[model samples]
Target: MSEAIRIRVTSQHLAESSNPAQQKYAFAYHISIENCGREAVQLLNRYWLITDADGKKTEVRGAGVVGKQPVIAPDECYEYSSGAILDTPVGTMQGYYEMQSADGNTFQAPIPVFSLVVPNLIN
Candidate 1:
């Protein structure tokens, strides 16, 4: 299994749904999962580690993403959008998916670390 799956992430600050004065920061993340192997794969479970600007860490573990366990065919991909709230303007998320191949073999597909930041907060 050569890089069985590829994960890409993008995020944005939802100012409309956030109250900076109240220490509430909202962010929405978009994840794209691409199957790069020779067989189809179904995402079974997900584990996430999120860290806020203040270094507060939160761990999330659940079945599938956003509610569905999608089966992705070879050369195909699935995408979803989800949101998170933090006590600060910056944070990061990283995790992996437990996947089962068409032949009933289970493996882990990792999702690299991605940042969630309010615009102009850095630089």
Candidate 2:
């Protein structure tokens, strides 16, 4: 697999009932993994490093996101969508994914830091 991890994030506003009335916030994300190499790759695990505007940090370590440890063949891809809760109006998240190739080689792809900011909150 390639050394670079391509990630695209799209955040949307949840229903007003989904969040506290006093806090203006929303949740959204789309994670897609593509195997661009010649060999097959199996997702081993995932780790998320979430940071809030209050300087609090949380580390989430677990096996396979959304359950199954998918084995992606060359040119194939898998995608997952999830939501996040943020205490403040703005925050960020970053993490990594562990994967093993068919040849018994393992590697990690770093997840780029994405922002979670409420629209019009800055103005």
Candidate 3:
């Protein structure tokens, strides 16, 4: 399938915000969404599937991201930073964005699976 939007993710372990003893692992992720098509699109909603090391899964569905429904023009990019807390030291997240094009067509833009791991957790 042709892609109209591309997503890139970068993750960081937040040591200062994590409590290993309590099984709380905090991670911050920066996401950049680029419109690769010829039309401008507005991100309407998001759906995420997060899985922890123990196979625990959590689903997050929300409207917009960081409180804004960003409209990205063709060849333009939108960036945001978000955080997630996991019970394990490592996990993975993947999802899709619901977008509406300027011409009124709606589509789903897939967000590639990315890892969320604490530094030095694995060799």
Name the top lDDT candidate.
Answer: 3
| lDDT string, candidate 2, 1-116, tens digits | 54633555666656552465665456777888877777788888988888878987989888988887888888788898877777777788898889888988788877888887
Q: Report the C-alpha lDDT of model 3 over 7-107, residue by residue, as the tens digit.
A: 99999999999999999999999999999989899999999999999999999999999999999999999999999999999999999999999988888
lDDT of each model, Cα atoms only?
Answer: 0.93, 0.77, 0.94
> Higher-lDDT candidate among 1 and 3?
3
Clashing pairs in 2: none
| Ordered list by TM-score, greatest first | 3, 1, 2
Whole-structure CA lDDT of model 2: 0.77
Which is better, 2 or 3, measured by lDDT?
Answer: 3
Q: After superposing candidate 1, which stretches have Cα over 4 Å from the reference? A: none
TM-score of 2: 0.86
Runs of candidate 2 exceeding 4 Å displacement = 1-5, 15-26
60: Cα error in model 3, Å: 0.3
| TM-score to native of every candidate shown | 0.96, 0.86, 0.97
The deviation in Å at residue 53 for candidate 2 is 1.0
Best by TM-score: 3
Q: Given candidate 1, what's the lDDT at residue 25?
A: 97
Clashes of 1: 0
